[model samples]
Target: MSKELRINSNKFIDQTTRLSFKFNGEKLYGYKGDTLASALLANNIHLVGRSFKYHRPRGIMTCGSEEPNAIVQIGNDPSLTDPNVRATEIELYEGLEAFSQNCWPNVKFDIGGINNLLSPLLPAGFYYKTFMWPASFWEKYEFFIRHSAGLGKSPTKPDPDIYDHKYYHCDVLVVGGGISGIMAAKLSAENNNETLLLDDKNILGGATIYQNNDCFQIDSTHTNYWLEKEIKNIKNIKNLTIKTRTSLAAYHGYNYLLAKENLTDHLSPDERKGKIRQRLWKIRAKKVIIATGSIERPLIFNNNDRPGIMLSSAIKKFIDFYGVKAGKEITLFTNNDSAYETAISLKKSGVNIVSIIDIRDKSSSKIVKEVEKHNIKIYWKHTIVNTEGYRRISFIEIMQLSDDGSGVIGKKIKLKTDCLGISGGWTPMVHLFTQSGGKLKFRSDDNVFFTRQE
Candidate 1:
């Protein structure tokens, strides 16, 4: 395949080493450090899967574990098959086989897609209401429902991979390896404490690593430069143990938790002969810091489940870190100021910024000014009413919000765009805290849920 969507500049990807993989039986090539999602975007293949209920076309929405779409079945071998794997989280490897699920016959032409037209008849409790009358025939109804409900197919044979468990005791345990987590681990280790830090990605510095613009500075140095220096300093700390590709799976009482460490999943089958596939880490820490960052929430619009509609942060990550552009012309719709950062990043990477539609009435922020200075149009108090295109987004219809902010007021204006990035502010990641018996309170200011301080 042609590298049409890939940027020419050298960034995080090692272009010297090329790896070939199969997606729905089509052979594709990607660089060494590219994820399956980034590789797919680089080749302009965004229709990755079908939705669960309506069978609507879905693409890669986010670049991490918070991804709601782009789940696929991995491996052709039954014994090695893994289903419901997030394409964004999987690292690219040679001979990797990925197939779209939840679609009958094929993903491109699925018969199950009739559910989209019949979605109006199928309400939230349609299954329970329709199947409850016939008591004796319930088993027959369940069999048909169960077969069509799930997304991917499970392995018929047992998994043929080795897995082990280990235990560790540390004075300080940091769940997220983002900039905040790294700083906490550094300070703990400097005080001679046994510090342990974990991150789901293979690299450190988190989102800060992708932020290369000079607008952000810390102590007169660029944010990326400062983060790089801090990461280098933390690596020299003796008491700190950094674990990459390790995700915190569960949090128990008394500061106990479980983390899953990926070992050989990123390697080729031939290279993973005797290596363990995964290891479970049972950790006990005296003190814990949950620094897991927030996830970008998408805007609610008509036909929003269509392919090529992704989160704003995911777009920035793909362009800044992976050197891949989702589209040549992009339109961003946001309700807050955070998405302006994505606009700047995309513009700097040579991607066309068609326009930015902000739901608020007006804004005088520096980022907004910067975006307008580049001649990018900003439509304030406007919201998308409809979207066009089937397998991928081709255009969107937007209108100005009413004075009461309850509905659209003006005529719909259509804009042609290949990609749409939406941001509805962020909801703090408090799942681990809530799992450990913590209470949460909703903040009305930003419409986010946060843990209540003790």
Candidate 2:
């Protein structure tokens, strides 16, 4: 109920149009353009779900489809209910009903939470080892196990929503709507080619729209300002068609692909009546440009899966685009320079940044200096060994990295924190390429799997 965490800023959200929704029976309010995850974060509700095996508390970890947690059941009616919907992808709508999955009774105080205390007894293959005796009795063991380990429940009744399919042919098809994809579409259309561009978000500019910092510039203009101008230019091209909220689901040989366009998911229940819920598009293009962007990989550490622990890039998006702060006090842990931008953004937004723990020993990057100039502390050659707090992160135990960078050394230092944003690096979006029979090559320096060129 209280929009205490919501900041008064001219971001993506329309402050005048307020939408009310319910999560686990509690009514909450958000703005017109806020996603379900951003709305929840604006209300300071982070513990959204529970893990499958241990039943540990989980939270919204990302701002997009790469989210590993924060999946919930949407809608109240049995036939209209959809399960395992990513909160990051769901748009906030009036009367939207959402409930966390996998936990018995409720997410906060779940009975299945006992499994966390019994974790030592349940290893990775605990089921295979414990259920092995008497192969004939395996059926009995499976019945109980099946009831315990899983995500949201599927609707027993038939789905009432309508879905249809279509076919299209284009001279050039761009799989992403990021800065690169938009430029590619513009260039192709200028050459008298029919260009079609697709993106998963409701907006076309992609991540470029959120780059509001002064560190990046294009021809003496801020990157975000320049990108907005470019997007307007692309919109004026007659031969170019841009489709937002359209996801490419499958890619086959000979430049053939399948995409799904969301039609009414962002609308209110009353407005969505009699409208198509989704449409499948079968595309045949002469040339396809795979401009899908990269995904930020989360750092691996002890108790890293706890609630309130999120990706650094996601934190930036929530702050810069949605005008929401993840926490009053935040600690960022990163291996590279990307997170420094997030630190600067949050600092400028009046967030109390506890410190930035960089695994690298030293950095003279301009962004790093900018963060330092803002009086934000930076811990170089340090890594988090463990974290504290049950439902949400309260503090973290950090230590100096070993000389060879294989382990941690020295005594642990504890710092109070409400949120931890970690950035391990990025993995290129190569799913479409691999699905189309393209081979991949792993880049050791960046620890990314890239498409192998002929």
Candidate 3:
């Protein structure tokens, strides 16, 4: 449980304020602006919960709303207990109580984990097929099925948290608060258009907000610093309304949308008194800008769902934004140049980067060249065939990619690492657009889908 307390850290987090919280009955301390996932990683507790079918150990794999694992029950009060909450998205606060979900006995040692051994007999949909043989017997099997299902426990008492709804109408609406979203909002407001910018995160600037790299700069200033000034300037704009911790849920006809705004979710329970916990925002805009940004697509390999196997983008965020190191020795695997940026950040933080396994033949990008200058070992045209570890990743098996790019052609090379950062590029977040009847065209070159603009 070592913390990388680099003096350069704390751009987003407040190291001055330490917060104490509990997970699975174990108390831990984190900074004021930390998330449960980040704090847990900082404390070296990767195994958080168990998987659905096999009951395999699941960890904090991502750092945002897209996190599929690390779900848990929040609080123990009958009226206030929230279930199946994403730890990555939840803010860390004093007296915050959370417990792992879907595990009997405990997350560390679960009886359900035996499902992995009996997996052959179970197969996919084994429970459904085996129990459906006799519909008459379903009545007898209903009790057992009901008991084993559900990820978390529902509250028995009525909810006491305050929630409200509101409506807004703006000339232009931006769905993201990233760099592009900030620029779009600034321009729209300066042009006398009433602009509304919404982002799911409690803070603006998206992933680029923490992106600290020499290769990424604007107007001779670092991208993050430059964006800070733009964000500050937008605050005085009369026509602009910036809503952080607000997520656009739906996009309907005539540019009408539904967004959920978290008013007091990040606040302490005592501070939340007389305050609305959440607000449902009904927004209408004459024009909409879909700057929802992209999410890092994770690469699939054997046992990729292990506790410490995370996306490179996530690993970067854990280090840069939260001021915490994901691992002492991390191995990065990628097919693009994105991983190089993560490598630089890790190296700058004094974390040992075991090696970089790249599937691409090579890259001449500035970021890649910078990584080369650091004398970091990069295996070009190489891919990780499999990763080894149960509760967490211990090492990965790598080999040279064949000429046809379909198979491995060399002897297996094993690399020892505590954490694996994988980058499969990114997928454009066009869900709202597609939900509103937008069509997509697949780009065969980089293998991503984009809207077919008019």
Candidate 4:
């Protein structure tokens, strides 16, 4: 972890407080400002979870709502163990317990990992085809399959925490806390728009909090200085409500969104003083500008399900945002420029870089130039043919791809690497827009889904 600490706010918290928590039945400690993800990382616990399919090892991906891993079972009771809850979004509270899912014995050395070797016979939709003929046999197979499938166990007892809902009217509801979202909320609140910024992260500032690239020149003062300034300025604006650690679960008619606020999750599990544990806010907004930004998509290839291999978005949060070393050495593979930024950031951590493989033959991207300046080996028009790793990554075979990056044309180049950060480009988070029944138009250049003007 980086020793250069940067404190961004004193509004919500002012002291370096400590909290106790449990993981996989073991007790641990975390700070007040730490998210469940950061707290887990701080405990030097990697492999916070297991993969959905294949039962592979998994860790925290994105720092905010885009987190694809570190989903765990919490609390002693199955009902209180929040399934699919993002560790990156949960605040650290005393007695908070978490466990990795999808394993019979444990997350590591999962007996289900034997399924990886048997994966050749179990292709995608294998159960759909194979389990049909012996429908009666499927009943028995599904019984074992369901037991082998999914992570975390539900609490058998009823939830002890009280959860409730309330109605809140606001002139502006910012769905994301990214750069654009923060700026938009600032303008709206300044104009007396009764603004409310909603973020799924324990802290705000979405991607800007993680990304270290100079694409937009985000002020590197840490903890989103601009976000703090805007929120500070809006303190007296009577109508502005900044809800952090809140997710807009559902959208109803009249531009109303059902938002869940985790109020006492970061304190003590028993600290609810008649206050709702989780409050559902029914927010009615005058206008909803979805600056929700985008999520990093992983490039599909053979053996991409390996333990250490992860999305480029995850590398940024692990290194830049949370000060956690993602791995000893990293190999970043991408079809775009952002992966280069991940490589550079990791290089600064004194970790060795095996190589940066790009799918493009040539490009004018500034990231390309930066990589060249660092003298890092760049294999253009190359893609991973296969990855080899057990329990963790050990090697990846890179093959030079054709100009369109669809086929291999040159000899294969195999290199030893621990991690492979894959970036297939950004997917626009248009869930809120789609929830509003908005139309969508495809962007050929970006090749991503986006909301269309209705």
List per-prediction Cα lDDT, in the order shown: 0.91, 0.91, 0.90, 0.74
Point out the worst 10-residue segment of candidate 4 by lDDT: 1-10
The order by descending lDDT is: 2, 1, 3, 4
Per-residue lDDT, model 4, residue 56, is 74
lDDT of 4 at 84: 71
List model 3 lDDT by residue over 247-325, tens digit each. 8999999999999998887877888899889999999999999998899999877778888998999999988898888
TM-score for candidate 1, residues paired by index: 0.97
Name the lDDT of candidate 3.
0.90
Q: Give me the displacement of residue 396 in model 1, in angstroms.
A: 0.5
Q: Which pairs clash inside model 4?
A: 77-155, 78-154, 78-155, 78-156, 79-155, 101-151, 101-152, 102-151
| Whole-model lDDT, model 1 | 0.91
lDDT of 1 at 335: 94
C-alpha TM-scores of all predictions? 0.97, 0.97, 0.97, 0.85
Q: Is candidate 1 or candidate 3 better by TM-score?
A: 3
RMSD of 4: 3.9
Candidate 2 C-alpha lDDT tens digits along 336-382? 99999899889888889999999999999898888889988888999
What CA root-mean-square deviation does each model show from the true structure?
1.5, 1.5, 1.4, 3.9
lDDT of 4 by residue, 128-152 (tens): 7877876678777878778766556
Query: How big is the positional error of residue 362 in model 3, measured in Å on the Cα after superposition?
Result: 1.6
Evaluate residue 96 in candidate 2 and report its C-alpha lDDT on the 0 to 100 scale.
95
Clash count for candidate 1 is 0
